[model samples]
Target: MRTYNIHEAKTHLSRLIEQALKGEGFLIAKAGKPLVKVTALGKPEASSTRRLGFMAGRMRVPDDFNRIGADEVRKLFEDDA
Candidate 1:
């Protein structure tokens, strides 16, 4: 995809950032509308940098952390017993 405008995207701003870093996608009209869009900068689907108690002193359980239930966490994860 490609369109360009604003002065041909500022005189081909480095070939539209090398075709939006190679992933490709564009659009930037103006007097005709469709204002902006470039694309190719999306690689963080998700992540909370989790694990390890997920907080507080980073984890080192066994202080009876607390909150056990749901039938003692399904009998401490029993599979068939």
Candidate 2:
């Protein structure tokens, strides 16, 4: 854990970021007081690789899914007229 002043942090931002990405976190301070810590982030889950039917067997869709709520919705609006 190393502390860098504001000026040093600004001057070597890229290098600091690289170090953080390599798991070498550091602290940035201002006026000799610590302010923020830099660290690497965990890898993100990939959306493209996610399974689409993750709950396929856990749920079922009614055959009339789309039309199931049509009548009730239409009546609500009709009563407003």
What is the TM-score of each predicted model, taking all chains together?
0.28, 0.56
Q: Residue 48 of model 2: what lDDT?
A: 50
Question: Candidate 1: TM-score?
Answer: 0.28
Top of the candidates by TM-score: 2
Clashes of each: 0, 0
Which regions of candidate 1 deviate over 4 angstroms? Answer: 4-22, 32-35, 42-58, 67-81
Candidate 1, 18-54: lDDT as tens digits: 8888888888898867788888777654455455555
**1-81 per-residue lDDT for model 2 (tens digits):** 999999999999999999999999999999999999889988777865678987779998989999988999999989956
Report the Cα lDDT for candidate 2: 0.92
For candidate 2, the 10 contiguous residues with the lowest summed lDDT are 42-51
